[model samples]
Target: MPTVRSVTDATFVDQVLLADGLVLVDFWAAWCKPCRAMAPVVEQFAAANRSRITVVKLNVDENRETSETYGITTIPTLRAFRGGREVASIVGALPRKALETRLRGVLGRGAAQGPID
Candidate 1:
């Protein structure tokens, strides 16, 4: 199974922001119902697009600093990073096809054929 690496405040820079390629950072909290609902969709999306993008989870409750830095006022927020910069973001729990379409638009169809690096 594909694992969603937990990103903390300390490692946020190295693991998500500073990383190259397309990185999808899911900002979530344990108690949020929407966050919980989006978990499986995010997981499956991560697995399916493992070669096109890097999917990571950041717990808002645990990574307060990072959450504040990103201005994540929502429970489930998805941000796309490329070249150490945020290129796009989506808030709320969307369906699988919608999520895939968004990712494909950001990463491109050709990215699916190659490694995530």
Candidate 2:
């Protein structure tokens, strides 16, 4: 099955900010149990929407710069970005249904445009 990919502080701009579609960024840490618990839900979402949306996970412990830039105060925070700016954010380890609802909201906001490099 398809899965969420990992992005580092160095790659965040190219991988997410400049991406061509909706991107769900999962802020997480290796030692956080909630982060681990939500991993599968993210991957499943990614797999199901592989053609329309992109899912990426950023390790907060390792990518402190990106995490701080995004003001991530909690693990498992899910942020939706399109056209170089953040459109929505959810902080916490939400269940699959809740996450899906968030994705639907993000997708419903219409299409994104232009390259954001």
| Model 1: per-residue Cα lDDT over 62-87, one tens digit each | 98998999899987999988766776
Tell me how candidate 2 scores on lDDT: 0.84
**Candidate 1 total steric clashes:** 0
Where does candidate 1 stray beyond 4 Å? Answer: 109-117
Point out the worst 10-residue segment of candidate 2 by lDDT.
108-117
- In angstroms, give how far residue 6 of model 2 lies from its true place: 0.6
Model 1 TM-score, 2 decimals? 0.88
TM-score of each: 0.88, 0.89
Give the winner by lDDT. Answer: 2
